[model samples]
Target: MFATESGGVRRNSLKDFVNVKANGKIAMKLADGDKLVRVRTCTEDDDILLSAHGGKCIRFPVTGVRVFVGRDSKGVRGIKLAKGDEVIAMSVLRHVKVGVEERDEYLAAVNAARRLKGGDYTKRAEDKARDEELAAKLNEEKFVRMAEEEEYLLTIAADGLGKRSSAYEYRIAGRGGQGIANIDLARGKKKTHVAAAFTVLDSDQIVMVSDSGQIIRCSIDKISIVGRSSRGVSIFNTADGEQVVSVSRLRDVNGDDEEGDEAEEVENGGPEAEAAPQGNEEGEEEPPEVDGAGEAEGDKAGGGEEETP
Candidate 1:
């Protein structure tokens, strides 16, 4: 765990974290500090610091400091700080906050997106449209980038059709970047992580990975295809058996399966035809027929051929 200080959040033990100092520690625009919740770091790892927010470590550096609760059969997860929290080694040291980094990265990205693509992420039908427009643009750009990267990961995994049988999983939940960041971590740490992920859901589903590099399913978040980006398209599974996959660019595998199954089916199912309005068989208009007499008469009238009644 860690303690928030003027310099920044410092490494702390579970036993030391107690109160929020009620004085020195400060909260910024986006951050909400538990006025009564103070923390300290122990000589140990961030576990005691973790205790402040209860055994739940979901909100790590965000919640102050944290410790790893032993992983049970259920899954890997954590909760917020505990009440009357004490079992923390709250270090009074300091570390830089990521909020600024987040803000800058998003700002730079959004500005670029606005200039390149004329989409108004800034939906300012309101009075404070200026700031609102800016924030909306930033958020949209961030989400789009996330979705595109996930698609890239999916395509790389679909190299072999033989991958349908096995799987991997991960259950990720966060308001911002934690889930994505953690997934990135797993991908790098595990062999063939990209080869195992196929469906990137907002929900967690992967479970296991073989030591050799194949993958198993975990309880990760389920990402949706509907209301999603047109990026990754391959469903993949690796023989190495690494379950969880990160949304990164192992390759520029994003594909547009535009003429996929649906397109091919429609084309092959019908005779060569132009797009036309539908109607009842009998109600449909018929093509004009030509009679031998009419053809001779028209030709004779045009002075091309003589007509024989």
Candidate 2:
């Protein structure tokens, strides 16, 4: 995944990395008031979603965008934004093909099972039976296997409200189009808009940074999953005047091998993998500036206010 300040898309090649390391090459040229927000490795088969603060989202196939050789070139427009709107997040989605009708039926059955398992008795017995029938039908369908491997899109608003929507909710479209809604921020309890949207798993953890410089790391499963058009429940409790500006997906650090590797890296003063902070506005803390060789220029890793992303 790659994105720029002016909502442009570009694929930076390994040659670009070699050049940047060798001669400190420019990544992508940005327009006035624009900066490169993110660059991530992704396969051509993956889908990409660019989310804006205005609650608009665009999804396009990664293979559709051409890779440019020039680093200073302004890439093609990823999404058409409304005035005063800007891109906040770009996510690489796993490709999953499921018809809308099958998905809806499968989701209904899954939700019913969840409610039933939760001991919710409000649903009628007939509803449970129908759900079971749908489940049986879905089990025989090819979509069921794809559904098991499906990914979810986590969308959080500035107010800290968010939801886990199935990646399938976002249908892939051609580039530069006004996309569909990723979250329903307008009718929510709080009058807020999207701050970030990215793909996440149930086992994943995320770090959210507030405008007040507050940071919180929490489990992704704790946040409720809702429909594409529904407003999300609050995931972070932000104080008045504070808003979540950046959210990063944390890598899984549960296994003993992973823990040992991380401990070894820390002891050796080696850099650990971390999610790059996004939408870090003016006055917000930032990662230390790195030189052409990818070494921090002035700030140490544990220095005050400056940390690795």
Local distance difference test values of all predictions, in order: 0.25, 0.65
Error of 2 at 222 (Å): 1.5
RMSD, each candidate, Å? 32.4, 12.2
TM-score of 2: 0.75
Residues 100-164, candidate 1: write the lDDT tens digits: 45545554444454444443445534534544455465557654554243321121221221121
Off by over 4 Å in 2: 187-190, 213-215, 255-309
| Candidate 1: residue 172 Cα off by (Å) | 16
